[model samples]
Target chain A: MGVQDAEPLDVERIREDFPILDREVGEGTDLVYLDNGATSQTPESVVETMSEYYRTYNANVHRGIHRLSQEASIAYEDAHDRVAEFIGASGGREEVAFTKNTTESMNVVAYAWGLSELGPGDEVVLTQMEHHAALVTWQQIAKKTGAEVKFIRVTDDGYLDLDHARELITDDTEMVSVVHVSNTLGTVNPVSELADLAHDHDALFFVDGAQAVPNRPVDVEAIDADFYAFSGHKMCGPTGVGVLYGKRHLLEEMDPYLFGGMMIKKVTFEESKWNDLPWKFEAGTPPIAEGIGLHAAVDYLESIGMDRIQRHEERIVEYAYDRLTDHDDVTVFGPPGDDRVGLVSFDLDGVHPHDVSQILDEHGVAVRAGDHCTQPLHDVLGVSATTRASFYLYNTREEVDALVEAVDAARELFAV
Target chain B: MVGSDMYRQQILDHYRNPRNHGELEDPTFSHVGENPMCGDEITMDVELAEDGETIERVAFRGEGCAISQAAASMLSERLPGKTLSELREMDRDDVLDMLGVDISPMRIKCAVLAEKVAQDGAEIYLGEKDLDRTSTE
Candidate 1:
């Protein structure tokens, strides 16, 4: 759908699509789920899609020539096509590969590219706000390859210091990987600009879109991202499936990271030939039902229009940020203006995040409390942990009010 | 006032003004325990008597929610006048009884961080095990 054709979301109608939204938490209290940053609630359509796939065509994909296998293969390939279209990948399904999750996708890049391309003097540039999936994977690979790893600094207000990024991305930089949207800080990075900068330095760029692709409109072609990774579970789809999109030329140049049955064209006692484009990277039986479920989720988002979802989450998060900061005891982290995405991380004076989250749970408000997989970023923020409340398309302003009231109850109980 | 049953007045008082809330000048055993998931940490410093089996004095330093800090404070107070064997024998129920509150399954780690630290410290002091630190992951 075009951006101009996007309509405002009817949140009340949308909430009905998710049965979990109607459930109760503690003492029969209505659940206020604000943990979308962790995992989004699946719609009934996506759930039904997976259930139907197992019930109807319960067979292996790609190898079997039987009717069920053909049907499953067609559906799985179509799922990849849907994902490629959703992200505006120019090479379409040929450039998209499925992995267990975003972590595995990054590992695939590290194994296929980093292991072969990087050497002792090569540098891998990453941001300080990266989730451990990107940080630890590259750290270990750099160690194994004897490649140096550099980190771009985050400003005190929680932004990637572009000046620092420019200073760091010089001649020796062989790879630049960054999070498109920070899970902890909710900072929406200028990824396209970063991608251009990396290309200018003759470096490969990778975007960890685990937090970005689900919440906003992303066109890999527009941003010129050499590689992008995202998970289905964070976007109203089932777990056990993720997507990795790379340029066709780069994908062809890199060797397969996984080796198994379906990914082989022919196998002999002495030699084996790899399969074509995406399947060469996708080994083993693959997550057949999960890929189909992700397709349904992509259709659901497309029906609602991503532009509209982005606007709704923007309003909800801004309102939440304002309400949370109104209290003297609360201190909200991240950018002060409207540059942030759909989450808010904050701390209460004299009250631990776990305590705040526990109290919020008592009121049936679910939130995330911890380092959010970015321990270094937490250290940079000068705090141990922060309570985070994230919003999605189905969230409403009333729920934001409920979150504020529960937070108030926590502060009052702690007498902070 | 939701979950007030878990945050009783005693827990709050101990959390606010923790007893034995400092480090000992010289300690027979000092160990740090951490629940990295919640960023809760507790450090216990115990000074043994001449007999080397009884805890003569103890102090604790920590940063965490009320359950962890209050439980650590209470554990520090109970350490003195208790033998090392008794300290080792202290279990989850004892910590729950000391808190006098219902700790949910998720917060049980926060509630029992102190007991683990002390017991592990006692083990290290006795040369029963060689370890760097303790973790309630």
Candidate 2:
């Protein structure tokens, strides 16, 4: 899919692929689902792929020489190839390691890399807008290794303070991990520039692509990231399956995250040798059926084209940002322009976010209301919580209008 | 207008025009309870003349969702001249029953916010703190 030749996203056609979109919530009210940032609705094809995998090839891979094992192994390895190509990883299929979710992927990096390399007098640079998964894992590694974790401050408008980021990345910095797109504020950080800066400092750059991979086109090779992590559920695939992409050289250098049966090449009473790049990271029996579903999800996204998905979400975000900003009582928090994903965080005057969400729910609109697991960013914004409404290809402009009307109704009813 | 059935008429009436939605001056006993998850802050005050263990005067001031604000207004109306023991004996079910409609389980906290504040105020009025006052236990 070339940039100029990308076909425009057909929302109605896409919505038809998701059966849950047709169901009504309360008293024949249409379900206006705007919570795609939390978890996307899987298409029928992806669901059917998982069902087909279980019904057909229900056997363990890499152990048995039987026909079922061979079929399962081929399916599992094919899924890895699809995912590797999806993310634009330079290495071949062996570089992609399956994990439980993005959180586990990040923990693998922190434990395998951070625990081994970082020690006393070492520093790790992070950002204020990171989800707790990235923040807590690094914090734990820093505490255990007697290293210090520093943060790059975020401005009130939710852009990264690049000057602070540059100042934080010094010679002592050993690793720099940041979110590609903020889950709370929806600000798209400049990962390529940050990656360059980390390379300049001789530090490894790990990009938390959990939020970015679902909404935009992610090319890890273009960004030159050392490690990239994303979850399948957030990308319209099933839960309990995620990908951890690493450069071949860095992956070979790092130790295995888990010591188990499948991760070992050969085990003796005294010594054990770990397997190659991906198998070393993936211990025990993996989520084989989930992997097949994720391959279907990747195919679904590719059929629609990620560039078109970005443009489609950009249009909706621009419209929603304008509508939200036009309201006198609304206080929007995030990037002022359309340089972000479809996630929008805002607060209405004198109304709590929970109250706003409840009122919207009464109107058959769904949204998320909380700190969004970005407490440090919330502290920087000086607000406790905000109501978030994220969009996807299945969302229509009419849903945006409905959200606006419901928000106005909530404000009028609360009189705040 | 929201449905009168979903939100009871009294609840909407109180939410639209609350009775006590401002701070009290030198309240005899006051405390602030906040839902950090949603940033809803409730500062309740209780002025008790206390005619033989009876709450002579009870009032509250806070900002929250409709359910919380309506519950506070109704509690203010019901607690004045009620006995301290009676207020302490109040349960979440009693608060929801007063709302005149059943609410989702998640919103039970909103319905009980005022009752908890009143109980805390009653405990302060009796000069007791850091003690469990819930009737369920």
Candidate 3:
């Protein structure tokens, strides 16, 4: 398709691909799903790919020489290649390791890398905007190793405290793990600059790309991330599958997180040697079907082209920000410009987020009402929670209009 | 499915103009209950007469969802004349039933935010410092 002739994403067609969006909660209201950041709706192609795996090549991968086993193994490894290519990994297929989700992927680094490299008096720098999955893992590692965990304070506008980050990264810092995007504020962090600073200080940089991967193109090689982690469910794929991309040299040096059947190259009674990269990190029965589903999700994303998706979401973000800012009661967080992704978090005057969410739900507008799993950021903002309405390719400006109208209705309903 | 009339007129009546939304003057007992998962916070204060067993007045101050604020408003009107024992016996289901709605399981915490605050305040009034007992209800 030519640039001008390329058809805009058909919301109705995309809506039909998701079966769950059709179900009505109350009355005849159509589901105005805006919670894509929490978990996106899977397309039919991804769901069908998973079902096909179970129906045809339902065998444990990389274990047997049978036809079904070989097919399943090939499909599984092909998924690794697709994921690696999608993320711009240069280490080829060996760099991708499948885990349960972003949480598990982060835990692998915390256990394998942090345990080995981090010691007492060492500092692990993190940001205030990181999700608990990234924060808690490092806190646990710090507790066990007696290493200090330094936090980069956030600016009042919810961007990273870059000045504080510079001060925090010292010679004693062992690693700098930060989120590529703020899940709550929707601020795209400066991962490339942070990675450069960490490298200068002789510390490795790990990025939590769970929110970044779905909204924009994530080239791990371009950012030069020593370790990167992301989840499939947040990107229109099935759950129980995630990718942990590590530098080949780093994965080679780190020990395996788990020791079990699939990860072993050779096992003896007294001693056993682990396998090489990727498989060394994956132990026992992996989520083979989920991996297949993720591959299909990558296919769907590529078909639309990441550049197109980015443009589409950027438009929605700009539209929503303008609409929300027009209201006198609405308080939109994050940067004012279209520098962020599709997520928009805000609060209405005289109405709590829970109340706002309920009123929106009555109109079939699904929004998230909570801290968005960034408690430290919430604490800094001095608000308990804010209602978030995140968009995807399927969302349109009309839906953002619906959201604005719902907020106005809520304001009138709760006028006191 | 809860009926189309799930949010009762009474609930809306309370939510639209919540009663006792301000503070109580020199309250004898005050407690704060926070839903850490969702960031809903409710602070309740109870003032007792000289007898100290009967609630003279009750008020709530906090920010939360409608279910929570409505429940708090309803509880303030329901418990002012009642004894402390009756407030302690209140359950989350009782609050939802009073609201006249079948809330989703995930939103049950919103419905119970006020009840938690009342229970915590009651425990504090009886000089019980432990929060575990208050959290159970």
Top of the candidates by lDDT: 1
lDDT of candidate 3 at residue B19, scale 0 to 100: 93
lDDT of 3 at A40: 96
Instruction: For residue A137, give model 2's deviation from the true position in Å.
Output: 2.2
DockQ for every model, please. 0.66, 0.45, 0.47
- Please write out the lDDT profile of model 3 over residues A42-106, one tens digit for every residue: 99999999999999889999999999999999999999999999999978779999999999999
Q: Which run of 10 residues does model 3 chain B get worst, by summed lDDT?
A: B1-10
lDDT of 2 at B1: 63
Superior by DockQ: candidate 1 or candidate 2: 1
Q: Is candidate 2 or candidate 3 better by DockQ?
A: 3
lDDT by residue for model 3 over B75-133, one digit each (tens)?
Answer: 88888877788788888778887788778777788788888888877876677756633
Predicted structure 3, TM vs. truth: 0.92
CA shift of A139, model 3, Å: 1.8
Chain A agreement with the truth for model 2, given as TM-score: 0.98
Q: For each candidate, what is the lDDT?
A: 0.92, 0.85, 0.86
Which residue ranges in model 3 land beyond 4 Å of their true spot?
Answer: A1-16, B1-9, B21-30, B47-56, B120-129, B132-137
Residue-by-residue lDDT tens digits, candidate 2, A1-416: 65445567889989999999988878878899999888999999999999998998889877889999999988888888899999998576877998999999999999999988999999999999999999999999999999999999988788999999999999999999999999888899999999999999999999999999987889999999999999999888999999999999988998988888889999999999998768898899999999989999999998888989888888888899899889778988889747778889998987778778888888888999888988778888878888999999889889999999889877777673
